[model samples]
Structure formats: C-alpha cells, structure tokens
Target chain A: MIEILLSFSQATGIYSFMNSPWGWPVAESIHFFGLCLLVGTVGLFDLRMMGFAKEISLADLHRLVPAGVAGYSLNVVTGIMFLSTAPDQYIYNPAVQSKFFFMLIAGINMVFFYATTANEVKSGDAISRVLFRAKAIAAISLACWCAVIICGRLITYYRPPYHWCLWC
Target chain B: MPGSKLGLLKLETLARLEETALSTWMRESGFAFFSALTVHSLAMAFVVGINFAIALRLVGFAPRLEIAALSRFYSLHWYAAVFIFISGMALLLAYPAKALTNPVFYLKLAALTLGLLISRHFQATFFDRPKVTNDRRTINLAYVSVLLWVVTLTAGRFLAYTHNTLLASRYF
Candidate 1:
C-alpha cells in the first residue's frame, strides 16, 4: 500500500510539492478549512434534524449539503496527500487508525440516513417526532465527526506509536 | 526606548510569563497542551463553519433561506467564539513568547476579530427583521468576511513555521 501511494505521488509531482517547507502547512490550512465547511453545512443540517433551529426548513437546509460534499472532497484530496506522502508514519499510528474508523462510521451513517430517513425529513412527507430515528442518526453522525477531529489531533502526540498497534 | 528595544522588553516579560508555574504546567503537561489545542480546533471549526454558511447565503447560495432565521445560528457561533478565546488564551499561556513575538500571530488575531465583527453586524441587522435584503454593500461585506477568515486560517497555520523566537527566555 505504501509503495503504490508513493509511486503515485512521485508520478503526480505531489511528492515534490509536499516535500517543500510550505507544502505541509498549506495542506493543513486547506484541510482545516474544508473541515469547517463540512461542519458548517452538513453538521448544521444534522443539528436541525436534531431539532435546533426548528424554523429552518429541512429541504432548504439540504441545499447546503452539496457544499458539505465539496468540503469532504477537499479533505479527501488533502488527506491522500498527507497519507501518501508519508505512509509509514500515518499507517502505523493508532490515532490515524482511530480517525479512519470514525470517518468510516460517519460515512456509513450518512448513507443510512439518506437511504432510510432523508426523504421524509426533507419533504416533511409523513414526518413524525418518530423522526426519532433521524435524530439518533444525526447524533451519531455528529459524535463520529467530533471523534474524528479529536483523533486527528492525537496523531501528532502519538508519534511512532507504541506496541499496542498490532503492526507497530 | 526605540521600537526594537520596546519589542525586546515585551518579549522579556513574556519569557518570564512562560517560566511561571501555571505556564510551565501548561507547556510541559501533554494533557494540558493537548486539550487546549484540540478544543481550539473544534471551536474554530464551528465558528468558521457557521460564518461560512452565513457568507454563502449572503452571496446567494440558498436564496430561499430567510436570512433572519439563518442568523439564529449566530447564537452557536457566539458560544463557540468564546471557547476559541478561552482555548486561545491557554495556548498563548503555554507558549507566551512564541506567539507574542511572532507577527503572524497578530495577523491571525486581527483577521479573526474582523471576521467576528462582520458576523456581529450581520446578526444585528438581519435577526429581528422579518424581511432582509442583501444590498450591494452587505454582499461586499460578506465577500470580505470570507477573505478575512481565509487569512485567519492561513496565518494561524503559518505561525508554527514562521516564528523566529520559540523561547525568548534564552536572553532573559
């Protein structure tokens, strides 16, 4: 996995750019900006479903979700830059592993929401306080994203992580 | 004193601040420093995120979203803003000279202040009004708010790379 990612970066010039002094911090800035965008949009939608900002129409708020998708795309691009550029450092780190785990949960939760609850919640079509399921999904989604952020911070502190990491 | 001397004097004071029991604990304790940094990031995301959402609306993304109702999120934004300051202060306490001696830190402070002021203006103007209109000036302010926030984030990231004095206590 590391070899393939390195080769891809080398071919794409991502290796050269990321190796530069400014590259890492620049990427960090963009990564954070993207996160804020996601939190502001998709997270806001989640909050509304959880019943904050009750006056705002769910369908109207749904429009901002595209911006959230855009933010998520930015994060993925920058994330690959970080991961591919230094696979050894991140791949073996337990914090990075936990971050990925939360991201996966958030992703799955999003899919499940759209599949089961989005339509009724958005259109107000037969919506109920039994939209309890929707609220639960929203809470889980928010918690997962928050957990992901915390884990991202922990990665810096846990360098060359200890033996608890099975591969480490 | 000349400008350079005054600057040096300020840094000397900050260096002593870093040596205090509280500052020492904040810097040396992994849990303390780590908590401050993490809370700062979390609060920042919410504050910046909410600001971005409002700016987008002003520039016409969600045309039907009543700007009045949208400003309600400002309550959350304000709450997060307070955390940003509290966490920010803890971070500065941890590395007094590191932040105070760096010009980039001041730039971030300035940009963030301006961004919040813009948010305050928007909230005060639109929140109570049943009808809201984004005039040309208001739209321009929104654009400027976005730029200010980008500057704040960039300047913040650059602080780690650009600081020339990590511990002014060397001279102290």
Candidate 2:
C-alpha cells in the first residue's frame, strides 16, 4: 500500500508542481496573504462581536463579514492547488485530516449563526440580552477556528506513512 | 579543574545532535521541508492576525466595539490560530531534536503562552466591563500581547539557523 501511495505521489501530474519554479513560493505567498486578509476581516469582526465597539452598528459591522468569507474562499482555492499537487501527502496526513474536519465544523458553525441569529441580528437585537444562542454560536465559532489552525499546523506531522491507508 | 584543558575546549567543542526518529520518519515520508517551513510561517498570520485584531481593538484602534458583534470573527480567528498551531507542531515533529534544543523555539513557546494568558485575562476583565471604553490597563495589555506575538514569530523564524541540535550524532 505504501508503494502504491508513493507511486501516486511521484506521479507526473502531481510531481510537475514540485518541478515548477514559481509553483511552491507562489502558493505560499498567496496563502500568507489570504491568511492576513482573513485575519484582518474576520478577526476584526469577531472582536466587534465580543463587545469591543459598542457604538458601532452591528449592521454596519456585518460589512466586514464578507472579507472574512473572501479570505476563506481564497484559502480554499490556493489550498486546493497545494492539495492537487500533493494529495497523498495531505490526504493521509493526520494534521490535514483534522484541519479538514475542523474547517467543516467551522463552516457548519457559520451556518448555524446565519440560521439562528440572522433574523435577530437583522432586527438589530443582536446586542440584546435574549441573544444567548447567538453568543453560544460565537463561542463555538471561536473554538472551531482555533481547532482548525491547530490541526492545519500539525498536518506535516501526521502524514500517513503510506497511501494504502486510503483503503482503510 | 577550573583551568583544565576540557574547560578551554568547552568553547570550541561542538556536540552534534542527531535528528530524532520522528523527524527522520517525516523526511522519509516525502513531505517537502521547505513547503512545510513556509506553511508554518504563514500560519502565524492567522495566530497573530486575529490576535492583532483583538489587541488593536483593546488599544483603541476600533472604538465602540460590541462584544456580541466581535464574537463572530473571534471564532474564526480561533480557528485560524488552531490550524496554525497544529501545523507548527507537525513541523516541530519533523525536527524535534533541533526544536527541542533551540532556545528560540522555547522563547516562542513562552511568549505564546504568556500572550494567551494575558489575552484570556483581558477578555474576562474588559470584554464584559460596564463600558466599552479603553482603559490604560487594557491598552497596556494590548501592547504587551502584540509584543509577545511579534517576538514569538521572530524567534520562530530564527530557529532554523539557531538550532544547536540539527544533525547531531545523538539521533544520527
């Protein structure tokens, strides 16, 4: 199984990426920029939710949410590029696996926010006391994103020794 | 013994530190060390990025902020931090001995630890304070938090060159 996985990893389509001079560094730089934008947009919004700026309209603050979304989207596109170039390295890697899962959880957590809090938020009641669910969603979202970063960091450590694990 | 030859040799004697079993395993597994290195560095943006947001808010970069409104982005920031940390650990595992012996690595860890502690304290104290105004204490903490992250990241970057245990005989 390891042999097959290694073979696949060394295959032409994937290996071509490593051969490309601009490929690796470009992916890296873009990933970093995306991270910064994501952090700038979403991180600021999260700080707002945590009561940093009471005078700022929540409605107005929502404007930054798309930037966070854009960051996530950019990461996804660049991330896919890296993954396509090195599928086995990431697929079998435990860190990558956990990152994928946490990312999924983070995504669902976002949906939950939109589903449960969108209405109240839209009504301008998001800052009120009855918004317990929204708060809960916020807390969960923070935790999930943290988990995603941790898992993503560990991906290099968790690569499966061989591709045969794919069958399992 | 104070003036012994070995004492003089201590300055010149360089002991090799070999790569650990885990690191060797990672290298053999075909992961590109260069790519992993870049990713690990990139992950910091997430960790420090969200942190900077929170810190800046505390320091008055954005006034009149709402805790409720901030919670949304905070969650995503947490996600980004966690992803970065996990990847960092993996990179560390890829070179455990080097990292373990590197003073810079320990420095980064200590800074991160302190930064988190202070951040949590700020959240508990100020996030729910009666007013949204930025107090001196909050501003101080914000500055300190940013300093810690910056130091931590710089130290992390320097670890590659400062490692005293890379390719040492212990693991080789």
Candidate 3:
C-alpha cells in the first residue's frame, strides 16, 4: 500500500522538487526562518504572562500571538510540501513516525491550553497561573519541534525499505 | 604505546573527527547520528531566537512593555535552549571525532559562548534595573546578540560546505 502511494506520487512528478538544485535548500531556509519568527512572537507573549515584562498588559502582549500563528502556518504549508514529495519514504520511516507522534502530543498540549487556560487568561487575576501553563506548553512545543527537525534530518539515514524484511 | 604511537593515534582521531558532508553522509552508524544533528539545529533556532527576542524587548528596543514582564518568555527560552543542548550533546557524541576537529564547530561554540555572555550581561545590567528603560547601550547589545545568533546559525548550516576534510577525503 505504501509503495503504491509512493509510486503514484513519483508518477505525478511530485518529488521532482528535490531535483532542483536550490529547492531543498530554499525550503530548509524558509523552515528555519519560520521557526525563529514563531518562537519570537509566541515567546514574547509567554514572557508577558509570566510577569517578565510586567508593564505590558495581557491584552497588549496578546497582539503578538497572531504573528506566532502566522509562523506556524508557514511551517505547516512548507512541511506538507516536504512530506508530499516523498510519501512512502517518510510514512514507513521510524524517525518520521516518532516525530509525527510527538507533534500530535504537542498539538494536544496546545488544545489543553486553549480549552482550560483561555478563560483564566480572560479573567485577569490568574496571570501567574496562566504563565505557568503557557510556559509548559511553550517548552513542550519546543521539544516536539526539535524532535521533528531531528527526525526530518534522519530521513536519509533511516530510509525505509520498499518492503518489510524480517530478520532475527 | 610510545610517543610516536600516541601521536599517530591522535592524528587518526583528528582525521576521523574532521567535519565533512561526505563523512556525515557516509557514516556507518545508521540513523541515530544524523537525526541528532538535524534536531540540534532546529532546536537552536527556537532557543536562541526566542531568547534574543525577549532580550531585545527587555533592552527597550520593543518598548511596548515593562522589562520585567518578559520573564515567562525568558524561562521558556532557557528551557528550549537546554533541550537543544541535550540533544546537541547527543549529536556530538555520535560524531565526536568530526565535531571536535572541525573549525566551524569551534566557531559555533565560540559564537554561542559570546552570545550567551552578552545575554547574561543584558540580563544583569538592564533587566535587573527596572528603572532602566530605553537605554541605548541595551538596545545596541540586543542588536549584537541577534546578529551573533544569526551568524552562529548560518555557520552551523555552512558546516556542510566549509569543512576541509569533506573536500580533501572521501568516505566509504
């Protein structure tokens, strides 16, 4: 099934992007820039909630959230381009699998923040508590993202066999 | 082993440690080593980038907030940096020979050191003094810190292109 999908992708000339001399590098550069902008904006907001930049009210700090969201959006779009170009190669790869799983956990972590912490943030009295949860989420996000990058790098080394080969 | 043998072993180690894309490409250890390197670079952007941004705000360039409120951001920055360091160490272990011998790696270490030192100074000098807002010195330092981090990151990427051994030798 995985091979069939990969062949279809290949037949479509999807992976041809890798053939371009500048394609991979350009994608990688953009990916990195997105990471910086994402961290910068979200991190600023988190710092505000934590009382590091206490002068800035939550409402003011909240402005930076959109920038972070934009960064995330860039990553999502570019990330898809990377994965689509090589389906089986990534789907069966262990490192990619691990990265995807961790990313899901990170996503869920964000959901918890939105579901539970969002109200506390609006209430205004719980800046300290909100800060704690925000920090936790930020930290986890960073870790999972790091894992994702590592796994992505490992794709070459952990190239999936076209078929499962059992050995003892 | 005698002095000559000791020298030979050290030479061999240096040769092995040389940073070359081909060496990285052809390393026999399988996926673990390379994966760690990719993770390290990714983690670096987050940790360093976030830290620099917060420091800039605290220094007064982004004057919208009181310097003290950025603490949460700083804490997250530190955590991200630490994660990168741990994973970075794992990467280093996988290719101790190459990393230790590579000049570019040394450059990265130096840049990180200098960057961190400036960050510490900014934290102590400006951040501690709540009254000190919009100081020119702080802003200047913030600019320098950001530049240093960019250099560090770029140098890290260029390691694939610049390492002497990659061009000089081939890996099988």
Candidate 4:
C-alpha cells in the first residue's frame, strides 16, 4: 500500500504546488466552501426525504441534487490533489481511513437511495412504504456524511505513526 | 495604554474572563473542548447547508418550489444557529484572547450577523408580503446571502491559521 501511494505521489506534480505558500491555504479554503455546498444541498434534500419539509414536492427538492453533485465533485478533485501532494500523510492516518470508510458508506447509500427509494417517491407508488424506506435511507445518509466530516477534521490531529521515507 | 484605550479595556476584560473557573475548565478539560469543537462544526454544516438550500431556491434553481414551502426550513436554520452560537461561545471562553485579537474573528462575526439578518429579512419578505414576486431583487438577496456565508466560513477557518496571540496576558 505504501509503495503504491509513494509511486502515485511521485507520478503527480502537485507536491511542489502544494508546498507553495498560497497553494495549501487556497486549496483548504476551496475545500471548505465545497463542503458547505455539499452538506447544505444534500443534507437539506435528505431532511426533505425524511419528511421535514413535506410541503415542498420531492421532485422540486431533488432539483437541488445537482448542486450537491457539483459540490461533491469539487471536493473529490481537491481531495485527490491533497492526496497527490502528500500520500503518506493520509494513507497511514487512522482518521483518513475512517473518513474513507464513511465516504464509501455514503456512496453506497446514495446508490441505494436512487435505485429504490428515490424512484418510489418520484413515481408516487405505495407512498407509505416508500416514505418509510426513504426515511431510513435519509437517516443513514445524514449519519454517514456527518461522520465523514468529523473524521476529515480529525485527520490533522492524527498523523501517520511512522516516519516518512520519501523514496519508499 | 500604548494601544487604543478600548483595546486596553477589552484586554483587561478578557483576562478576567480567562481566569474564571468556567473558562479554565473549558480550556483544560479535553472532552469539553473536543465536544465543543465537534458541535461547532456540525452546527455550522446544518446552518450553512439549510441556508444554501433556500438561497438556491431563491436563485431560481427550483422554480417549481414555492417560497412559502421552503420557509419550513427557517426554523431548522434558527435551531442550528442557536447551537452554533452556544458552542461558539464555549470556544471563545476557552481562548478569548486568540479570537478577540484576530481580525478574521471579527470578520467572521460580521459575516454571520449579516447572513442571519439577510436570511430573516428575506423570510419575512417572502412570507409576510404575499405579492412580492421572485424578481431580480429576491435573487440578488439570495446571491448576497450565499456570498456572506462563504465569507463567514472562510473567515472562521482562517482564524486557526492567522492567530498570533493565545491569551491576553502574553500579549498585553
């Protein structure tokens, strides 16, 4: 795993850029802005699915999903850049590992949501059954995303236990 | 006295607050500080996230959605705001000098205040005045609200990076 990460980092040229005075700070700022966009849109949609804002049509609320996707895309790009810059810092960090775990759960939950619950809600078939399913999925989505954010913040506090070998 | 008269007064007040048992406990207790940080971050996400949804609606992203329907979220927004405010105060008490001395801190506070005001103003406008159309003015306010949130979040993040003083005693 370390060897793969080392090779990947070597292949990328973002290190020098990330090491620049403005690069990391600017990237961090963008990362946070993207976080707000993602959480705000996606989280609100999940709340709606869970029957928070019942007055707003599910279809209309789903329209905001695209903005959430954009935010997620921005974070993924920035996240990869950060990894490319310093693979060792994240690869061996427990917090990063947990963050990835939560993200994977969120991704799977999202797929499940779109496959079953979203369709059920959109088609207006078996409203009660779909509402129950949607509520469960929404709860899971919210929990996973919140966990992801918490773990992401914890990364800075928990570093890799081992010393870095640049040539490893 | 070398600085502004108000600066001295503020420093003295902060110093006294820092010596209080509550402040000391908030600072020295590991769990308390960590919990407060977590609450602050989570609350920020909710407040910013809910506000973003409303702002996006106002910007005409979801024209089918009624403004009145979206107003249902304002209560959630306010709830999160209250949590953020309480957690934020705990954090400030923990390190009053760190935040009080930073310009970015003031910027974050200003942005938050303005963002909340804009949100309240628009909510009232949308709910109270039934005839107000989703015109350019409404959209403009939405744009401004989002901008202010961006500023507020950025400023809050920069506070960690930009602080030069951790306590009033050391600096003053």
Which candidate leads in lDDT?
Answer: 1
Clashing pairs in 1: none
Query: How well does candidate 3 match the true structure in TM-score terms?
Result: 0.64
The CAPRI-style docking tier of model 2 reads: incorrect
Writing each residue's lDDT as its tens digit, candidate 2 over B1-172 gives 2258873344223221124555555545544554555556555666677666566566654455554345344445556667567778776666665676567788989998898787566566644444556678778878998788767755664665566555432221
Question: CA lDDT of B55 in candidate 2?
Answer: 68
Summarize candidate 1's per-residue lDDT along A18-127 as a digit string, tens digits. 99989999999999899989999988988988999988988988888889899899999999999999887888888998999999999999999989888888887645
For residue B29, what is the lDDT in candidate 3? 45
Best by DockQ: 1
lDDT of 4 at A86: 79
How much native contact recovery, as a fraction, does model 1 achieve? 0.79
User: C-alpha displacement of B79 in model 3, angstroms?
Assistant: 7.1
lDDT of 2 at B9: 49
- Interface RMSD (Cα, Å) for model 2: 6.5
How far off is residue B88 in model 1, in Å? 0.2
Task: Tell me the spans in candidate 4 whose CA falls farther than 4 Å from its real position.
Answer: A1-13, A162-168, B1-12, B128-132, B168-172
Top candidate, metric TM-score: 1
Scanning candidate 3 chain B in windows of ten residues, the lowest lDDT window is B163-172
Sort the predicted structures by TM-score, highest score first.
Answer: 1, 4, 3, 2
Which residue runs does candidate 1 get wrong by more than 4 Å? A161-163, B1-4, B168-172
